[model samples]
Target: MINVRSREFAVPFLQRLIQVDTCNPPGNEHKLSVLLQDVLRETGIASSIKSVEQGRSNLEAVITGPGSRKLMFCGHLDTVSPWTTAAGRYPPHGAVIEGNRMYGRGTSDMKSGLAAMLLAAASLHQDGIRLAGDLIFLATAGEEVDSCGARLYADQSSLAVLDGIVIGEPTGSRVAVGHKGALWLRISLFGRSAHGSMPQLGLNAVEGMMEVISLLHRHALEWQEHDPVLGSSSLSVNKITGGVQTNVVPDHCTIDVDIRTVPPLQHGPLRREIEARLQEIQQLHPDYRYQVEQLLDRGVVYTDPAQRLITTALEIAARQGGAGDAILQVQGVPYYTDGSVLHDNGRLPVLIYGPGDHRLAHQPDEWVDIDDYLASIDFYRELAIRFLGTAEE
Candidate 1:
């Protein structure tokens, strides 16, 4: 097995990334982009930062060569809100290392992967390792919210020619070929307001919404579409709001349902099914009307298993981690990422591989095993070597 302990700069770079506090809701990725841009500058690599929204920016750096084949590395800069662990052992921004683990907000959710990509690419640039294709590094903003940075990049015509892309999402050193998408919908229920004392006089919107929720669950269970690797899709009512006062019957209710969908499933049919279910609820209650709105519909993304990127990642994982540690396999997680944007819009193939456990994402005192972190530095470094051949090789 290859020893990565000597890669002294990777952990410190990740520590600096975690300390920047690019917490979403007000994701100030522009600040971090400036810092990253400075690092690229010191490597003598040209880069550009484009603003996605106020205080949010996307950084793109290209290491161009004489070849037309292009490969890109992507990592999200925004992170979820800070949290305290159940044991109350560490602060979110502490970036503390105990034994072989580092705990902090965004530490696992993905500053570490971002750091690995940045450092690997920077090292390549500093060493002047020429390749057969252009090497593009993209640090995206608003990945935790809307993937605005990815959408921005997808709009550019220049990137349509990319041969492959690797998203540095926390994958625990595994290579993920695909993941489920999210169809977040908000449904509104309406009813006649009446005094709570005389409930029979008016319909209750909350009760109507409850019925709709039940119907949603029933349909979700009956839906036969399931991915072999991703398993069956799922629906859950994550949020519900209604009722202004206890004395008066509520006239309105709003509930948000999150549906995790597998790729190859058309989102149109699901949306239509939801509408039909809502219509059924409305028809049963003549006095009540229902409304539905799509809050978000991020599509599922999958790179074909036959793609060179997948084969190469598996090969690299095997070579770097040896037989026991590198358990690289084709798998899917129940989450949406900027890869959805690239796959759906730009028609690009994206592979997800990195350190850190996905279970720790958004958790209090989130942490990554230092060994995994160091292992990923080797992963990214070797991946670059395999994708973009070195001069001596």
Candidate 2:
């Protein structure tokens, strides 16, 4: 059993993490990674910091054991931007505690989970517990935006050694077996600009883009494939911009599309379909010109419900009087996680289990129950022990 002081260590640690703002647009996650590294060092654990970019990095600490099997505890350091409004009502990085919940921007979406995993690893080291396999703690940058840290780590590290992974994404303490894939695209239309009065002289890019939007809307409605566990594959045009002035015929227009997909709907094929449609439009209108930029491409994550990692977690949850049957009922989240990039194409069994309600993620007044946060520490520690087993075993 982990020491009772583990709870005491986790709350303040989480509070400090929330206090440090690592918002995504300018994800200064290296700041939080340094803090985490120092905390691990104090517990006599050696960790390495890998730079992702200027002021962005990923942190990895490993507890080496005799066996080759490995288990990784992963969480992202970056969070969504805090609410622009309601700053006075709920300070973004305040880490304010009201009764059982700790209110902050990253508290639920999930700095608390990151803190819990870190402390859990530290507690194992502090208690001098040696496992039969390596236990890894990975804190990544840019999960809320690009997943650059995870991609860098995946490209550089030897992932074949890992047998399983636990992603501390807020699941409200329930275990999630998978999540939807993401395919974000930015489509830009270009044409000749001219005065609005002589619209015939210029090819209107905004008008062309409107046609593209209509095509996309029709496709979204027509293509309806559903995954029983992950729900439906869907598309939405989240953002669009064009035109300098109302009087001028716009020369450029761009639309950002957010596409969430499930099984059987691969990103490559879907992307090519959009490109093929653009070609058709060009064929119809000789002057039509466009460019499609893939902003992000993350594969879907799906692990078998029968995987040892998940079964063991469910067993532990039941034994600990956790979510019980709710935790046992396997499901997948709609939002993508670092697991999407790190899962090695569903080869690795990644269990998404952590404190905080999934609904609270990215919402204003985000919070994680203090009790849930503390409980997750024990859950992580116990799962590591049971899955890896002690050296004596």
Candidate 3:
């Protein structure tokens, strides 16, 4: 059994954690996971590290209270790539306190939220607070990449049994109940290779691929359906590669696409639709040869407005912040996160509320307001108290 500590002890520990650099892309997260295990142990929060991929790991800890109802707090331990700016990676350069602000990478994109969860668990455990349910803390890895951590955790038999989940992604104090989903596709086209000088001799795969892109652009008009919360689905042709030399009319071209979907739209049908559209184009231009394959698929997420978990979080935020109707419903986010994976597959009521500006997440001057970090911890702690009730020893 691990022994827990007070809030004061937890805070400095979190700061020291923020002091560690665990940036992804060759995400060196094991060392940090070990550090977290040490910190969590200090508060009697026993934890275990699980991994599907070597080096990338997820950490889980639990504080048993006095109830059958279970409440889970989850945040990613792996951070996005650091800024290519002056701050650099080592020492995380500017993690200084300029009066009220705390400047550093992962500080906002959210080491702050991660810190809050740790402190909350320690504080609640040390106080011997009684609860309505067991409290689970999950710090996952590879969230900034594919949702490998969330997917692995959710697939666990134990995680599937949880009653509810709260994902600490920066929502700036509002109770965010939903997020859009993402599908990554790669479209490849084939054509006869010909010398650049003889333009018409060989088929131009680049043009054939562009034709498909044009069709996709036209198809976007038909796909522009919207929902009350997640708005319209979006398509972005982010990357295209073909042709080896400036002079040659390349025989192959491939395009990478990103598709964002709202809740009502599932991936199976959407994928079929895309394939159908491509097939239609193929029929129209029999000479064209192409194939479409999924690179990544993530489902959309939205809790019913009346869900008990969401309502509880809103009420807690409202009472503590004096903002009654503090439910935040948002549309498409440019990128994807594990929140959607947890909500869509785990089928657990999930919300993302934390501290920091989304824009500064990976920026050079990335930082979080110290007050915001502390306040978010307070809010989450109150939420734990409410959901877990008063911990009964």
Evaluated with TM-score, which candidate comes out highest? 2
lDDT of 2 by residue, 224-335 (tens): 6799888899999999999989889998999999999998899998899889888998899878788999999989899898989999988988876655467667788888
- The TM-scores of all predictions, comma-separated, are 0.94, 0.95, 0.89
Q: Native-vs-model 1 lDDT? A: 0.82
User: Cα lDDT of all candidates, in order?
Assistant: 0.82, 0.89, 0.76
Total clashes for model 3? 12
Q: Higher TM-score: candidate 1 or 2?
A: 2
For candidate 2, which ten residues in a row score worst on lDDT? Answer: 1-10
Residue 181, model 1: lDDT of: 77
Alpha carbon lDDT of residue 221, candidate 2? 73
Q: In candidate 3, where is summed lDDT lowest over 10 consecutive residues?
A: 326-335
Tens digit of lDDT per residue, candidate 3, span 345-373? 64787777788877777777677777778
Off by over 4 Å in 2: 1-5, 321-324
User: For candidate 3, what is the lDDT?
Assistant: 0.76
Model 1 TM-score, 2 decimals: 0.94
What does candidate 1's lDDT look like per residue over 143-196, in tens digits? 998888988988974666888889889987888888887888888988989999
TM-score of 3: 0.89
